[model samples]
Target: MTTFTSFTFLLLPFVVFHVANAAIFDIRNNCPYTVWAGAVPGGGRQLNPGQSWSLNVPAGTKGARIWPRTKCNFDGSGRGRCETGDCNGRLQCQNYGMPPNTLAEYALNQFNNLDFFDISLVDGFNVPMEFSPTSGGCTRGIVCRADINGQCPNQLRAPGGCNNPCTVFKTDQYCCNSGSCGPTSFSKFFKDRCRDAYSYPKDDATSTFTCPGGTNYKVVFCP
Candidate 1:
């Protein structure tokens, strides 16, 4: 009653506006899923190389889909099932040497909402897969191999390279003294100032890698 401050009253409107804006933003960004477009779920009867599909995902989400299944290299004499073959039949070795599994798993869990989409049932391999609506292309019969540079290294194969919603960007070859390709060591150096590891290619661009002791390298693909 003794004092009514003009300053206090003037600031009230601004504060209220800020709070209202924040509330509106929260409402818009609340949901973890988004509507997707493409073949109906479980309707992917056949997927051919160079084919394209689309899926719409929530805006807040990271890149769409996760590929849990690994590409396998079968032994000529083995039975042919990847999981049943000798050495676990995994395309690469188990553990750190193997391709990034958790990365893909996390992606799948977040996008698919923990739903399982079998690639085999969709006319493909038995690995995990998901779709993203961000992409576009023609859907048709009599599939043909696509001529995208830096994507299909094996040009000889027709109607047999690349799958919709999934593409093999590049095959990395780690040049080590052992003559095998892979990350052979892990290190954090320079008083822990820098930590480094390897990464696979994406978007036709090689990964930028830095290692301990100031060792840095970029993966380059050769025809």
Candidate 2:
């Protein structure tokens, strides 16, 4: 009985560690149309309207992003292109998707054992999105449900998405490559529509949000 108690005690920490560091991401498509959901470490999934996909993400994952690809055509082998958010023409994205896509960016178990997340339009906007925490008592959520696509500026309009000024001009002013930049008229256009989203590269002050570690998240398209 003593030996069994010792073994059980040793296992407790492992179970606690696993539960405290892992997160589940539920991605859903509420759009009237189909959406190809893309994630860096989670790969990709075809989500028809009302469909959903779940992903298990490990602790300490950084620079991770989730987004939706529209108007994609994949072959039997999962090789294809998307009108927006194409990641090297592969259904299972091995890298970040191309621009003109709304983004859900996150970092898990960072400083202070907190999870950081945000909805970003720095790459651009294609679909409406809502990113929220479903667990860990995190109540705040972010959303970008603007008509940016239909009202996209002429220079930034793409085939099936609204391109960011950086994609159209590629200048440091729009890209913030020099590490010193601020909002522009173009960034304001996006910020005005979606106040919760990161309209520019340095929009951290208001755009970024935090939750306690082990928080599960839900990302919904057209929410």
TM-scores for all candidates? 0.20, 0.92
Q: Model 2 segments beyond 4 Å from truth?
A: 1-20
Instruction: Kindly list the per-residue Cα lDDT of model 2 for residues 16-134, writing each as its tens digit.
Output: 58546679999999999999999999999999999999999997787889999999999999998999999999999999999999999998776666778999999999999999999
* Candidate 1 segments whose C-alpha is farther than 4 A from its true place: 1-46, 62-64, 68-223
Candidate 2, lDDT over the whole model:
0.90
Computed on alpha carbons, the lDDT of every model, listed in order, comes to 0.19, 0.90
Cα lDDT of model 1 by residue, 132-173, tens digit: 111112111111111321242242111322221212223233
* Cα shift from native, residue 65, model 2 (Å): 0.6
Tell me the alpha-carbon RMSD of every candidate: 19.7, 7.9
Clashes of each: 3, 0
* Shift in Å, residue 207, candidate 2: 0.3
